[model samples]
Target: MAGSRTRRSSRTRTTSLTDHLKLPDGYGRPPEQAGPQGLDLARRLRALTGVDEDLLAWVWYERSKYTALGGVVLGTSVIAAFSMWNFVNEAIGEASVLALLPAVVWLLFVLNLDRWLIAPQPNAKRRPGPLLMRLAVALLLGTVIAEPLVLRIFQTAVEERIQEDRHGDVDRLRGNLLRCNPDPSQPDHGTPAGCGSYLLSFGATPGGQSTELDALRKDAAALQKRVDQDSHALEALDTEVREECRQLIRNASSGLLQRTSECLRLRDKAAEYRSTHHTAENERRLVRMNDRIGQDGSRLTRSRGTFLTARNAEITQRVAQERAKQKGIGVLERMQALEALTADHTALFVGVWMVRLLFVLIDVLPVLVKFMSHENSYDRLLSARSNSAVKVHSAAVHAMERESMADLEIKQEVTDQYVRRRKAESVAAHREHVAAMNIRERQTVDSLEEELRRPSTV
Candidate 1:
């Protein structure tokens, strides 16, 4: 009996296990039970993610789901790392502890981004928005990541171009300075020295026309001195004439008016010395000297103006050159050079993009190929098997319901029969009791009658 009980208990446990393995009424059977192909596919999918068959079937259609998702995540990580590296490289020149924050954030974003790319939704129609957004973000990120690396890889050429740009800037500044100076002989002309001293001295020293200006100034001074001497001689002669006229008038007396007139004429004649020293000739010489001085002064002024303008221009050019030198080539400048280089070399740009696209395709290919392929035979078989399971479960439920209804009817009929029999028995028992009581009462009446008859005879 002990052995039998143990065997029965083992059997009950096996039955319970089998019952547990079976699907619920509405739920489908395992894909493996559906067919060999579905079973094979289920095993493959199970091997891929190490998830149970039921859960896998509910989520993914095939093994490619795993491959595609993994590929997307892996590719996103590669691109994101490079992208973050590039950003950190350009922003701070070298990586730092602070840079790691953005790197970590970027990595998390990339991981989540993959999920965002392939996140499941109930409606297939609304999926394109998310898919396109992911693609756009991936493309943008890939471009940003690829551009800096590509440019860095070609650093030699880029640096060379930058050096060329610097030289060009220097040459431009030099040309501007030369144009401003227009005179090479000046100490400050078209040179840093010239520019430095321009404001202090007004370019007055060692200029091209310095000697000529000095000579012209000296000539002007000499002419001025000669004019002054001529004026003094003329004044002395006028004084002598006035004094002689007064003396004549005093000597002639009031009656001799004609003598006074003669004396005035004599004084005028004495003043009129007729040599090269004559007042009229001296005046002419002074006028000639003044005209020459004016011409010399005008020429000197024009020459000075020219030199000063050139000096100012040289100063401006020098200042600009210094500023440009101080601001050297930077990241933006290098980037601009790369852009121009790419424009000039279309093949290079194309090659770089092709490499980037290759990486992107590596990431997205699994998803694209899986989705684009026709429905798998396993999937179709599973669907059919699920439908059949549902139908069978529904039929079994209906049959159980019918059996339950039949059992209920039989139970109800049995209960009614039992109730009726009990009521008949109860009624028969009550009738018998009444009959017994009537007999007893009759007997009692008979006895009483007999006693009364006997009593009357006595």
Candidate 2:
């Protein structure tokens, strides 16, 4: 009997629990059933994305959430990997560790970037703020990161163009060299004046000059030497004539009283010698020498100045050409070459940005298509079904709570009634027991009195 009572209590508790938790049938299913066409579309989307049907019904009612997520993951990965590769290449020997830290941080940032694309939906209708912000960031990053790589991709073409430019420079330099030394027969031809045999030295006998220049220089030097000798000769003659003439005058004056013919003849001889050597003849010769010297000196000065100026100019031009040739094919040099070859900096700028824009558009395509597409019939049905399920679940919980409260009130009333009755019964029994005790006490007292009276009779 005890075992049977225990089993009965356990069964009652289980029944109550089930009744409390159970919901109405067909609560989660749609009130109006979907046709075959609607079901077919849902099935196709499920197969394509591989999302669970229940999860699709709840969160991704309009589109394939799985496909969208997969695309974002793939694109982000590709972009991150490409960016990291370029960073490593640039910083490998310089600051490998420092470069890697930023690359890792960027990778993490990009991987979690889907949050910006997907998180703004309070409902299906409002546009997401994060989506716009993300697209702008993507475009900027693409431009900065992709430009150098694109330039590198076309390096072969750039190098070829640089070669062509180099050849042009060399040809121009050679032409300038020819202009500096025009004579084909001379050793200076086809060479710069600084390096040519004709302009190796300067002065009366400068090297590597034409025959006419050499003759002119020699004539100028000879005239200069002859003029120096003539000047010294003229000075000596003047001094000798002055001394002889003074001596003649002194002799003639001393013998004035005698009036001798010898003195007179000596004076005449002095006068004749002075006139022959120091007067008109020598003076005329000196004047002629001066004129010739002046003419030759000026001619030589003009010729020398013209030649040196031309030669110096040619030397400067040649030096500049050599430096241009020596400019190596390094990164900075290559960039300069590219600029020179293209010539239009504005066009290059526009082209680089256009490439970046294309990449940004490609990266954001899947996100835009998924979010911007219109909701279909299957989505509406799924949303309705989910709403109905939620309502039924809520109703079941409320009903269970109300029933529990009512049952608790009835149990409380029954317990109170039973307690009152039991109290009343106990009070009545106590009153009767008190009355009986009083009666017993009175009888015992009477018996004691009668016994005392009988004892007296004995």
Backbone clashes under 3 angstroms, per model = 1, 2
lDDT of 1: 0.60
Candidate 1 similarity to native, TM-score: 0.43
What TM-score would you give candidate 2 relative to the actual structure?
0.37
The regions of model 2 sitting more than 4 angstroms off are 1-73, 92-109, 115-122, 126-343, 377-458
Candidate 2 structure lDDT: 0.56
User: Per-residue alpha-carbon lDDT of model 2 for 82-145, expressed as tens digits?
Assistant: 6665555443423355666666776656555543454323224434685576666655655555
Instruction: Report how far residue 443 has shifted in candidate 2, in Å.
Output: 26
What would the TM-scores of all predictions be?
A: 0.43, 0.37
Off by over 4 Å in 1: 1-54, 57-61, 95-97, 122-134, 181-331, 356-458
